[model samples]
Target: MVQSVKPNPQGGITVTCDNKEEHFDKVIFTSPLNVLTKVADSSLFESSKPKTPVEYLGVICLVLITKSSLTPYYVLNIADKEIPFTGVIGMSSLVDLDQTGDEHLTYFPKYVSANDSYWKKSDEELKSLFLEGVSKLYPDFDTNDIVSAHLHKAFKVQPLQVLNYSEIIPDVQTKHKDFYVLNTSQFVNDTLNNNSVVNHVEKFVNEFKTESNLQ
Candidate 1:
């Protein structure tokens, strides 16, 4: 894990990882924006901080290993306000049966804001709540078919777009020459996903190469 990152006056940025120090001409930070705020040294940025104060949504995903598939569709978006989960992702529908060891894999994803009460729920509570919601949706789904249940939670899953986002978004280039902030928060017109990430990185690489040549 990276402990700290500071700019070296001579040249490059000095990074401290696991108590050891190393110098790098450039640092490409791809982790979540919140991580950057926590790990980066105050002096690393030109103004002591980047102007990226963005809110991120969290997710609590419950994975169910079942004897039979729940839905034929790969994804079931829950439109009802009464439902607990935002969407149901049928992993089994997308993956081959052999890869799942002949079992069905389903995901119940619930997105939560920072102050959402779902964060306080224990594993058992979440299981009960999720299964209850699932049961209501698919009456034919049997509890006996559930081979195993797993809960996964991420506090910072993705950035939530806010008002005047374009004006306040963090730049790829920081005041400090060697330090750059590149993350999902920079995604203005595109959705946050694997494809967008790859495209963004490729775009950044091309631009950086051109800029480096000019410099």
Candidate 2:
């Protein structure tokens, strides 16, 4: 775990990890935008700290391995309020069956507020709740068909794109020299996905390269 970040007297930045401390000429923080505020020293950035109180949505996903396929579609967007999950991703629809040993893989992803009470639910409880929704979606779905199931939770996975979000989004370059911030939160215009993540990384790298050449 990163304990703290401070500016070195000589040059660069000093990062204190749980086991050791290290100094680098340039430091790029890629964690969730809100997380950086907790682990790093805001004062190090002088007056140009990232905006605070950014709203984010956490995700609780149920990964299911089943004897048969769930849906022919790759993605099913849930619109019913009764459905606890936001969407169902049929991984098997895209991935080759040989890779999964002919078993089906499905993902039930639910987005919730950071302070959502659902986060407190036990894995078994969440699994049951999600399975209930699945059963409703597919009347033929049987518990016996499920070979295995697992729960995965991640906090601050989605940044709420409020009006004029670009105006408030943090700059990659901070006030302090050689310190930068690049994260999924920067993905304001597009939906947060693997493609957007790759695009953001490429844009960040190109921008960093341009800035470095100027210096």
Candidate 3:
């Protein structure tokens, strides 16, 4: 795990990982916004700090392999507040069944606060609650159809896109020369998805490469 990151007085940046330390002429931080602030020296990024710190939403995703498909559509957005999960993703709709041994693959994702009680629930408890929610969607859905279940969680995967979110979003470039940050927090205009992430990475790479050529 990375312990600290500070600008070297001579030049470049020094990163301390565990007991080892390494120096780099250029360092790109791809970590989450909250994590970057905690691990790096605050002094290095004083000028780039946002007027208000960006807020994020945590996700609890449950992946299930089953003998039957849940829905025909690839995505099912749940607007009902009573529902435990945010949405359902039918992976089998886009993926080839041959790859999954003809099994159905579905993802149930819940977006909640880090302090939400659901976030602290045990795997077994979450599984029961989520599965119960799924049952409500399909009255005939059978437990026997479920082959396996997996749980994955991220504390700050999605940014809470509040009003004028772009104004507070941090820039990829920082005050520290050769030090930069390329993260999801920069994804302001678009939704948090794989395509948005890839687009941001490509944009950063092009910008960085152009800057590198000038020096």
- lDDT (0 to 1) per candidate: 0.83, 0.83, 0.85
- Pairs that clash in candidate 3: none
Give the range of the ten consecutive residues with the poorest summed lDDT in model 3.
42-51
Query: Would you list the rank order by lDDT, best first?
Result: 3, 2, 1
What's model 3's lDDT at 26?
81
Candidate 1 stretches greater than 4 Å from native = 5-28, 41-52, 174-181, 193-215
Backbone clash total for model 1 is 0
Model 3 TM-score, 2 decimals: 0.77
**Candidate 1, 109-169: lDDT as tens digits:** 9989989999988989998998999999999888999999999998887888787777776
In the range 47-113, model 3's lDDT, one tens digit per residue, is: 3668788888889988999998988989888988767898999999999999999999999999898
Q: Is candidate 1 or candidate 2 better by TM-score?
A: 2
Tens digits of per-residue lDDT for model 2, 100-203: 99999999999899789898899889989998988988888888999999999988777888888777776644667778877777776798776778888888
TM-score, per-candidate, Cα-based: 0.75, 0.77, 0.77
Q: What are the clash counts of all predictions, listed in order?
A: 0, 0, 0
RMSD of each: 3.9, 3.5, 3.3
Most accurate candidate by TM-score: 3
**Residue 158 in model 2: shift from native, Å?**
0.8
